[model samples]
Target: MGATPATRPTSTPRGLARVGDRVSFLYLERCVVSREDNAITATDDSGVRYIPSATIGVLLLGPGTRVTHQAMSVLGESGAGVVWVGEHGVRYYAGGRALTRSAGLVEAQATAWANRRHRLEVAREMYRLRFPDADPAGMTRRELLGGEGDRVKAAYRAEAARTGVRWVRRTYDPGDFAAGDTPNQAVTAAAQCLYGIAHSVVVALGCSPALGFVHSGHERSFVMDVADLYKVAFGIPAAFDAAAEGPEDIAGRTRRALRERIRAAGLLDRAVADIQHLLAPYRRADEEAAGGKAEDGTDGGVRLQTDRDGTVAGGRNYGAEGVW
Candidate 1:
């Protein structure tokens, strides 16, 4: 689901693909892409298009597209966007119609591979058992994450724990629960890492990022889902010691540093393994959501499972407007 680098659809896509780059996108119908010439063109197909990034206008995720109205309004308002990629190869526009207001979604089941007795599942299961009251869908993101501190501290107490005093700093970093991004690089970095891992997991499972157990929409979908179990693995100790916030000016800089840290952790790899195990469950969810198979075989081919990406792939069978 990633961009051209991690096999994402775009080329040179820190934000969007650059012109003269070879791109492979599936959700073209979700929006109108403005090319290099400032000419805007609406997309419609599950088909992959190699448009010069410069020639792209807005990447249109049109009416029949599964994007959200909030997203529609947002993207319609702004001319720029970022393509997001998860560990399992999820690649889609970060600010598209499906997740304009909500940002992005990675819908997948928590128990997609619950039956597996592997070490990863075992570890995840142990984490789940810690909070029996927690919902698989993430009914209480703020509440659950708020309580993660204690569980994180408990991990420090574990005899098997290889970490030491530094773990304490991570657990109690004041920077973790702040507003500004720059002032809290450590905490922000930890959160970004956790979210990146969670996003990757959702894509691999082929679930919708926007759907969650406790969460609904607009606040990042699968982020809440996997973050519940996945984020705690790293941040419990690291973010705990982070400063509450930094200067407002350096906020964006701090976020960049945070992204670097998250990327260095290689959490995406772990999520990929975990997500692949859940594929069977996600497929079932997809089927149920679609109310059986696609009338003309729309979903299940494109790996990202994003609203607009699905719309693009659907173009081959359905019309450019994503009609079946």
Candidate 2:
């Protein structure tokens, strides 16, 4: 006879911690991940270490990491994001679940994105957040793009001067990471890390990564927009600091430094607040216009679309209304 199987508990949204309250991300590699009741175990040459599944916001599976199906299922149930990345944050492969049950925020995003005026307003808000000293009001998209470019270039020069690293213009060859200097390598590594973090938050909030205001024509356009908001505060400084140490392991050092900076700054919490703020008006309009349908997406049920912004129950046959 076959042996009996162990029972696994299912996790619900209310049972898991909020995204802002959990760890930003945990990076693992060269280990086998498997489920152990409510926690996941990472086994390697060292030993087995158990991590609470519900406490993690994002899990970065680096090179050589092998995760079992049961482990992935548990992570999905806990609403934790999983991202497959390169050893030193050089590449990104794919992403896992959206970790949301309701479609309120995404609906709001789409509604605002569909209108040209609303889209431009959101873009201006993003720039306003980035450049608090300057006013982006009544600025055209072309002006916003120019100002952003100048600000970023100024940031690069400032970091280079502070760290005494040879500063050339930003250059990145995705096919060859080593072609760039130490600062460039570090910057790229830090940028990838920030992107991963931003993506996790975006998906968790039930927003579409492809629908972006400041950036467009990319699958991760919204992810890039969110990540750029923190580049000056976290990514650029961390990269320069790592490069100043030496080029021995610039990428690894950058990741570590960036992680520390993110944690110290409580960036996850701030990011959550900023995203909510950016979409608050749309969310309110959705709620008022759609009768409180724009909630935080913990309904755990699906709905069908009806005429005039109404929803009907899902998984039912409505064939009784005859008229072929």
Candidate 3:
């Protein structure tokens, strides 16, 4: 016989903390994840540890990790995204949903993307954030790309000089892990981690990951766009620091350094605010009219769309009114 209601686990995500207030992401491997009431139990040879599902923003499952259905269900209810990555975050396999139930932010994103002038303006704003000292207001897309390339190269050189690590051009082979040097491996690891974090934030805010201002023709273009804004400040330096420490276990060391940097910088909070700011002009005013808060939805409720940019109560017998 099936379990009774009182014995079943709670599936509602009500009263959970906001995603911006949680950890950026948690990386785990070589462990089994199982459900333990509201928290998840990670079991390994070292023993079991309980992690509150609602406190996680993103859970990165690296190679050798196994997760059960019950654990995933609780995570989904808590509005946490789950990303499956290769060892050292070399490749991304799949991703899960974020914490939002409303479509306000995505509508805003689509509106801005469909307009040429607004799209370019958003792209310029992104570049401005990347290079706070420069003005990208009047620059074209090509100009922005050129400037970004130059700045990135300069950042690489600066980090190498500061860390006393010999650096060359970035290189990576998807099939072969040892083709690149220690620095390249570290950089790749850092970039992948940043991508996971950005993906989680974008989805958490109900934004489309494919709608990008700077990048195009990729599924994760928007993720790339958002992650690049902090490459100079977070990813590169962390990678270089890990490489400087030692070449042994560069990927592990890089992840540790990057995690610390992300926490110290309060990256989750900053990312949430920056994204909202960039898409502020396009935010739908009707979001509030739909009976939800602008900052993440209220209770993840469902509503029906109506004509003239309006929303109505869902789960009704409207078919009798000829409005089916």
Candidate 4:
């Protein structure tokens, strides 16, 4: 009898759709990841082990990890984000695309962001959610920014006092991590960690990380915005605690502590919910308009409508323009 050839798996593992699903972050150093038996396998100095790619939110590739083309393909298909970081996962260099293909949420995000008034409304909504005890209804963009800054300052001071970590000021040079003071470095590391987590969730939810309400310009502006919303609750405390531990292995310590805090607070699901809530007003408005039109017997076949500037009105025309 002739020898049989090895065959690839017919299907890849499906990623999590809902935010409540259990997803984990895998950090590997000096390892090679490859596809084996329909699962992602990582080979390091120890041995080879399977990685549940579908349930992974982000794969943090630090230092000497080599990823095969097949492994990358599987991860891409599974909607898992691959982030390249520096030693100890302190610096984020690049990332892969989100696995979600839904255009409805993306369209709604663009529509809301493209309009100035709607964008302000979304910003206000974010502020309200972040500070539920206070009212941001009458606040302007500048006022909101001021309030947020004050709140963040207070959070840093509070966390410093709680953790017994000295607080002088927040100063850090991203290019040179060592130049910053201990607390600064810890804060930066913690924020970066939160940003990575937030980015994974944002991508998984099928939303644009570029289009942001309070933040703009950067590629991961939306990610920063979302992460900022929860920083007072997670990042600040994690940084302070890590700083209190002294400078020995600060990066690794901060990462581990932040991960524990995130898990304990159910941060992933909260992030997903916050994204949905931030975009909910726009989604609700569209649904209500559609419903109202339907009730008035004006249910014409959906057609592309544009304003004077050629911006898509009543949500994007996904068929003609493609998802933004």
For all candidates in order, the CA lDDT equals 0.38, 0.81, 0.83, 0.73
Candidate 2: Cα lDDT at 314: 59
Considering summed lDDT, which 10 consecutive residues are worst modelled in model 4?
4-13
lDDT by residue for model 3 over 118-209, one digit each (tens)? Answer: 99999999998989999997899899999999999999999999999999888888766667899998998888889888988898777999
TM-score for candidate 1, residues paired by index: 0.37
Per-residue lDDT tens digits for candidate 2, residues 33-123, read: 9987778999999999999987887787878999998888778777677877674336674454555566667777887888999999999
Which of the numbered candidates is closest to the native, going by highest lDDT? Answer: 3
Error of 3 at 79 (Å): 2.2
Q: TM-score per candidate, in order?
A: 0.37, 0.87, 0.88, 0.81
Q: Which 10-residue window of candidate 3 scores lowest in summed lDDT?
A: 288-297
Off by over 4 Å in 4: 1-17, 88-100, 284-324
lDDT winner between candidates 2 and 3? 3
Ranking by lDDT: 3, 2, 4, 1
Candidate 1 C-alpha lDDT tens digits along 172-200: 23333333232233444445445544543
The sequence of per-residue lDDT tens digits that candidate 4 reaches over residues 1-324 is 322113444231232344446454667778998986446899988899997667677787877889888788766656667777674325664354544433446667898999999999999988988888879987899999999999989998988888888899888775777788788888887787777777887877778889999999999888888888888888888888999999987877887888888778788788877887777666635444554233334422233434432223343335645532
lDDT comparing candidate 1 with the true structure: 0.38
